[model samples]
Structure formats: C-alpha cells, structure tokens
Target: MPVRKLLSGLIGGMTPAGRFRHACRLLERADHSVRGFARLGQMAGSGMVAAQYQVACAYLDGIGVPRSPLEGMRWMHRAASAGHVEACFSLALMLLVDPPGQDGADSLLPTAWPEGIDAWPDPVAATHWAGQAARAGLPDAQALYGYLLATGPESVRDPEAAGIWCARAAQAGCPQGDLALAVNHLCAPDQPPGSNPGAVAALLRAAESGLPTAQYMLGLLHERGWGLSPDAAEAEKWYARAAAGGVRPAQARYGVMLLRNGRGNSRAIMAAETWLRRAALAGDREAAALLGDLHACGKAALPGDHEAVTWYRMAAEHDHAVACRMLALLYIQGRGVASDPDQARDWLQRAAVLGDVAAMTDLAATLLDRRDTPPATPAQAAAPLPDFRAMAQAGDPVAAFNLAVSLHRGVGCAADPAQAAMWMERAAEAGVVNAQYWYGRMLLAGEGISASPSQARHWLERAASHGLPEACIAAAQARLEGYGGPRDHAGALAFYHRAAEAGRGEAMFSLGAMYGGGHDVPPDRTQALHWFTRGAQAGNALAQFMLGRYLAQGLAGPVDRAQARHWLAQAVAGGVTAASAELDGMMLADDHAAP
Candidate 1:
C-alpha cells in the first residue's frame, strides 16, 4: 500500500495490530469473529501493543499523522516490552539505523526496555530476548542474533551457536538468515584465501530457499567464473529473481541485462537509464553522479539537459564534491547561462571549500581577478580585493598559495611579502607545486625570508620533480646559466619542451630562437617558424617580431605581405622598438616603390 493510505487508516481510529489482523483476515478469509473496535477498546496489554506500533508508523510518516521518529521509537518500545515478535523485529531494524534522540538527550531509546531494564541491549539482554525469539521460531530476531554470532563483530562467533539459530530460522522458512550464512561463506569461503566449497554449497541452498540476496550473489558468482562457469543468461535469471523481490541494485542489474539482450531488446541503454534514475531517486550518491554524466554526455539521450544539472545541483546541495566542481565550471564559463563573475567565483569558492584542489586553483585565479567592478563611480573607486585568504587559512593549499601571491604582488590585497612567504611555505608543505617554485624565489631573493640560494634551489628542485612547467623553466634556466649550479643545456632543453607543451608563450618563443639560431639544437627554420607563429598568436612580443622577420625573409613558410604587415604591427604594438623602426622603414620603402 502507498504510505499515505496506511497513515489514513491509522488516523481513522483503527489500531495498528487490529488493522493488520483485519487486513490479513479480509485478505486470507481466516474468519476471526473479534469485533474490530470493540475488541481493541476492551483490549488488555497484548492488544495495546499492536495499536502502539501502528501509532508509531503514523508518527513516523506524518501523512495524516505528525512526523515523529522518536515517538515511533517510543511506541516501538511499548510493543517490544510486551513480547511482540513484529515489535522485536522492528526494534532490531531501528537499532541497526542511527539512534533517535530521547528525553532531550542524544540517543536512540532510553537505554533499552522489556528485556532487562537496567541492562538494555547489553550482551545478556540481547542474548536473552534473541534466545527467546529464536526458540519461539521468530525469523528476523533469530537472523539478527545469528548474524552477531556469525560475524563476531561485538563478540566471537560460535559457529555451533550460529548453526543452531540458522537451522531454526531456516526451518521457520526465514530466507534472510540462510542468505546471511550463504554470504558469509562467499566472502571468506575457505578459512583462508582459496574458495570454500562448504560456503558455496550453503549459498546454493540459500538461493534455492528463495533468498533474494543469495540469488543476487549466486548471479554474481555465475557472471564471474567463480565456482560456476561464466554465463550471462544464467546470471540474468538469478538477477531477475532478486529484482522480483525488490532489491534496488538487483532491479537495476536485471533491467540493464534484459535491455542488453538485443535479439529482441534494443532498449538496453534506456532500461539501464531508467533503473539508474530509480537508484538515484532512492538516494544512491554514485547513481546520481553516473546519471548526471550520462545526461551531460547525451548517452541517455538527454541532450542539453539541465536535468543532469539539476541532479548535480541537488547532489552538490547535499555536499558532493564532484557535483560542486561541475556547477563551478558551468558558472565559470557562463555555459548556456548568463555570466555572473561573482556567482562564478562563489561556486568555485564552494568547490575549493570542499577541498577540491583544481577548484581551489580556479577559485584563487577568479578571486584575484574579480570582475566585480561596480560601474565606474563618480567618486573614488577602491579596487576589488581578493578574499581567498580566509579559505587559505581554512587549509586549502591552492587558496593559501593564491593568498600568498596577492600579498606578494599587491594585486587585490596589501603587499606583505613576509606573510606571503609564510603562506606560500604552508602551501608548498601541503604539496602545491607552484608554491614550491615561489617559495624558492622568496628564499633566493630574500624578498620574504632570509636569502639562501641553496634553499631556493632545493625548493625549485622539489617543484621541478613534480613536472611543474614554470618551475621547470626557472630551475633549468638557473642550472643552465650556472647561477645555483653547473650549466646543463640538456636540462634546459627538456624544461623548455615541458613548458612549451603547457602553453607557455615565452618558452615557445625561446624554443623557436634556439631552433632558428642552432645555438644548442640543430638549425630547423621550419620548426622555428611553427613555434614562432604559435607564440606570436598567443601575444608574445618577441615571437611576433621573429615571425615578422621570418615572413619578410621567406626563411620558413611562404608568407603574403598582408601576413607580414599584421605581425609587424602586432610586434610594434607590443612595445618592440626594433619592430616599430622596421615598420617605418618598410612604409618608406613601400611609398618609394609606389612612386
């Protein structure tokens, strides 16, 4: 039944156990002639226990009732104290979950009731109640105590004790305990490493007994080549049984498997998608992320979907890091949305706050360049200061390094080289690569810390070891020039290659110069032109000048006058004085040629 209808039945002046018994009688035609309300109204202790459990459900759901888990637990306690089998089962399930607060104190129940008042759920109390239920042929309580003994989590598992309880429950037709033993055998099977034949036999018996979990495990065993020969069709059959019993993961697996059987089923992806959505809705975090990715990529035919975005947004709201980063990027690039730099920065900040290192880096960059310029004021306009220091202090390594940069450069905050060095030191220690490079700089120059070339080289080496391009470039330059150590041109070349791939404009220009002049590398004007053109387009002034020279001399690719003039103009604009002079000379020559 829908939970709403169940709640209404309770609120309409019907007792829980009475209603259950009535429903069972009506369904089964067991012909119990007890007057429903009269019997309940005249009921003694045992009868009230049913009403208490029903009222507990009403309180728990708040559908035609007031939502109150604590109240539910209280009533559950009442029924449990009366030696109710269902109440004991409910109590066991509730205890397995988080405890509800009681009497204004943070705990589940008031230290147990019914079994042993002063010693509730203690070894003795749990054993006594569980023993009574086990002997009385109750299934779930037997399953619980059997599990405790079988796993030995709180106490040692007496296999003999476990066997006795499991046998009783199995005889009572409780599939769960049998399934539990089956699972225990599957995981540890042999007492040590290899497969346990005894455990496999136990699982097969449990599967035959209609235990859904066992069926699923048996499906996994067949799906893999474990104990059984690998068989997709056989696995699907077991999975179907588990799904029929309402196991969420099994439902998903079975649905996807049926979908994949393409002889008649071409809707495998769709079926998988539906099951994934169901799992996501049922509070599976990984399912939410997977569904979001499918939607985002259109693999689920959900193109241009904010449905995935909404899922991600919901997950992010619930504090998922990957979801936070996804939202952060959407805001950062203004993808299919209005660009709001502050909102972008805020999202990035949230991701950083959640300890995402990449998000921290992006957040630091955004904070340092906040486009939060309120329209040019008629009064003095104070510069927008980056506030990533707070996050840095909160232990974000990237934020720490960024805060240090702001302090060192006075970009968005006051210049305090000392503080900058301190934060940079912290960030470097925390494993941020660039922080190591900058930390080295501070040590070398005595800009923030005491000057020590050796310490500078040490930190630079650390950064370089991690393949930090900028650090590599700087370290290679220092080494090749014999500033901190002996010249190593080979190291310089390797560093240049690393920096160039990372899109460093100056490194590309330097590589082109090396190739063009054949100073250290073999002369190759074709390669030089390629690097020079790439660097020039990226706004490197020297590269622009070099590209213009190559075009004028026809030393690399054939170039038209239009291309040469464009590069010359760019070089001049970038403050290359020689390019400016050459532009004037070329203009004079062009005028002379025209005359």
Candidate 2:
C-alpha cells in the first residue's frame, strides 16, 4: 500500500494502446465465457478504475462475455476488494438490489457474495470507494460519493463522512462535489443549523475559484435555493462566471433560468432551449432531463414533442434516475408515444434499482391499477401480488399509504387493519398529507391503535401544516363539527382560508358563503362578493353560480343582470341543476311578457 509501490504497480499495468486493444478485443469475443474474464480481467496499474469497471461489467452482464451473472458478480467484487472505485459502485448497487439482511430470498436480489470474497457490504460502501478514488483525484466519483454519503438514509449514509469526502474533493479542485454535496446535505431536514450555509459557502468558493462544475452548481443553488438562500441575481452572477469558464452546463442553465423567470438578458425562449439541447448532446444529465421534460410537457416555451422522450431515453440509458422515471411515466401513460405497459414496468424496475421512490410507487400503482382495469380473479388476488410493501418499508410515501390502504381494505391482499395502521403511521410520519389525514382518522376512531384524540389532532395538524388543501378542509370540518375535538370556528376559518389560498375550489366557495351568511367569521357582503368573484375567475363552478345569485338577487354585490346571466350560463354549463332551473324559470317569465 506504500505510495511508491502502488504507483509502480499502476505504471507496470497495461499500456494505453494495450488497454485499447483489449477493450476492442472484448467486442469480438462477445460470446466468450464470463469465467475467462478472471484470466483476461487483469488490468495494469495504469488501467484506470473506469477501465477496470468495463471489464467487470462485461463479466457480470455477459456484455462481451458468456452469460454468467455469478461470475460477473465475483469479478466485480475482486476489483472492488482491490479498492477500485467503479467496482465499489457496482458492488453497492448490487447490495441495494439484494439488501443484505432479512430481505426474503424471493426478492430477486443479488446473491450475497459467497465465501472467499474479501469484501462485504460495508455500511459506507459507496463512500468508502469514492473516498479512496477521490483521494487519488477522480472528480465524478468524488461528487457521486459525496452525494450518497450526504443524502442516503443513515442506514447507509453519513453526513460527517460525507463532509470529509467533500472537503477533500473540494480541496483537490473538484467543484461538482461541492455543489452536489451541498444538495445532499440540504435534502436532509435533521441536519444541524448552518449545515447548508457552510456547504453553500464551499460551493461558491470553489466556483469562484474556477471549478466549472462548482460554478454550474452555484448557479443552480442561487436559482432554486438548492442549499442556499435563493437570489436570482446571485444565480445569474455565478452562471456568468461558469459560462466564462466554458462550462456548457452553466450557459444552458443560465439561459433557461432567464427564460423561466423573465429576467434580464433573456435568451429567446427557443434560443435558451437550443443551449440546453447543446448541453444534452454534450452528455449533461440535467440538460437532457430538462429537455425531455420540456418536450414531454410541451409548453409555449418548450413545445410538446414525443421526440423529447427520445432524448429522455438517451439520458436514461446512462442511469439518470429522473430520466428513467420520465421514460417510465411516458411508457405507462402512453403519452406522445405508443403505450407499452411491459416496457413501462421494465423502465420502472430500472429506475427503482437506481433508488427512485417515485418510480417504485408508480410501478406498484401500475400493477394495482392494471388489476383493476383487467379485473383479476379472486384467486389471482389471493396470490402474493408484487411485494409493494417492500417499497413502503424502503421509504416511498405513496407506497406506504397504499400499502396501508391495501392492508386495511384487503385490496389484492388479506386485510390486516393492525398492520395497516402501522404502515399508515409510517407514511403519516414521513409527511404524506393524505396518509396524515387517514392516520389521524384512525387515531380518532381507534381503528387499530387505542383511541387517542390528542394524537389524532397532532396528525391532523401536521397534515394541515403541509397545506394539503383537502386535509385542511377536512380537519376544519372536524373542528367545526366538534368530532373528537372542541369546536373552534376561528380555527376552522383559519384552515378554510389556508385551503382557499391553496386553490381548493370548494373551500373558496365555502369561505365566500360563510362570509355572506355571517357564519364562522363576521358577515361582510363585500368580501363575500370579492371571494365569489375570485373563485369564479379561478373556474370554480359553484362560486360562479353563487356569484350569479348574488348579482341576480342583489344580495352580496350590486345587481348586474347581464353579468348574472353570463355566470348563470357558466354554472349551467358545469351541470348546476339549480342554476339551470332558475334560468328556465326566468326565461319562462320573460316569454310570458314577450307579447
């Protein structure tokens, strides 16, 4: 392990031309046995970790070797054991695929390394490898490792460890690690105060000190407050600095931000898009991911083009989790592309493999929905459906909620209300607003746990804190009804106001009615009319009808017969029967006077 001998070992490894020839030869031997890689896998000390990874991949995936996942796995570990960074990444990925303990063997996970392998699933697997590689100076691995250590659950991740790696990487002139590390820490709510400020300072310092990746990250941070206070001005400043450094990503990001926020020196929206396209071609995942989204969503800014899926597919090919989710969603929804349920499942599986919770939830939902769409038989339902509970246990909020629902109601599985309560509790604690609502309901009713109204109120308050408009409305309703809690009209109005601000049409209309009727809050005809008008403009049909009534009856606002008729027409169009009946009666009266 001495530096001189290690360097000598590396120098004595394959020559540049020899490594190239070896890689090329791998193409011609695509059908060879993976076991042969053990003999051919020897890389000179000069062979970089990435190059060794290519060899490990060939052995594990049958890319250029005979199909033998076991041999491939063994070879990958050998390289990993030798402290190769990419090999460590592959090993970590394998571990995630086959979580070490208590994961049922049937989970289709990677077989744990057999006896004789020197390495095991170390808690800091990803970081350990990255640290070694980073210390020797590898930018991508440093950034990746720092990010993993900073954000992954404590079951695997470590912020202090992440900080150490980030500092080393930053000192060694790897700017991307600084920005990515900042984001990693920023994503964790439990971090000590000033964690983000310190991380952002490091990123800014690195960016200003001339690391292109840092500059790009600083631009993003200032753009979205990724780990720092959002300041559009500062974003543009860092972006300009990065652009001056010839970072294609910075130019594209800066252009896009200008276009999005309508700031100074605007790139023609299309021009900005063109810069993103350029960055995408240059292999920027962020650019490719953004372009894919733009193409998929087609706005006045980025026209909806199925071709965006193509770009997304390309980016996803390189293991971009967001791109993977995007592609899976498209395939599942059949949007701007042929619908392929199977392909959607495949992409979702891949995305989940890359640790995408959204993809995992969608996949579980797809299976559940597919069963409903096609109507699986009772026997089929009895059979173990895909273990979506794994995803919930793994920290997918939606999945956690759905898992609770399934257990509570016995959908495609047996009913287990007690278990359902446990899952719901987890989802609620994790901040799924709907789950919070349900968990509160369960607590209030003692569905599984013992009755605890105080706990129920706590959960409801948390849901309200998240501004789930529906939950706020429901909680307000509960409070007003004095169900499991004391009545507080003032508090109810506060929640209704929150729901109204969040654009709950029903809540908005109700707020208007309460104001008009002097219920909940003091009656203010003017405020009622204003609220009704605002709600109607926001396309709330009920509000439209109520506002029309106010005008026609001269209740809350000055009568405007013509405006009343117009809003009445709108309400009728929305299938408001009372409005239709009123209009019919009015027209009949008008006809009676027509002569």
Highest lDDT against the true fold, candidate:
2
lDDT of 2 by residue, 1-595 (tens): 8999996586459786565565546554745434335434554234455445666677555564555555556666667777786676666656444333334533333455544443444445655565566655676567667777877647757777777776666666666666666666556678743356777787677677687767777777777766567888888878867866778878778657756765323245666676677777777877788788767655426455466777789889989987998887666544456456778877887888899877777666556656556534575455455566877877877788878878877777899989999999998888666689789888888998887877887788777754556567777877777766787777887887777765667777877887887565688888788888878887788899998888888896567877888888899988888988877776777689897
lDDT of 1 by residue, 252-274 (tens): 67655764674433366676667
Q: Please list the Cα RMSD from the true structure of every candidate, rounded to 1 decimal place.
A: 17.2, 20.2
Instruction: List residue ranges in candidate 2 displaced over 4 A.
Output: 1-358, 366-385, 391-399, 444-454, 482-491, 497-503, 533-541, 562-595
lDDT of each: 0.68, 0.70
Error (Å) of candidate 2 at residue 326 is 11
Q: CA lDDT of 501 in candidate 2? A: 68
Question: In candidate 1, how many clashes are counted?
Answer: 1
What TM-score, to 2 decimals, does candidate 2 have? 0.41
Per-residue lDDT value at 233 in model 2: 84
Shift of residue 138 alpha carbon in model 2, Å: 29
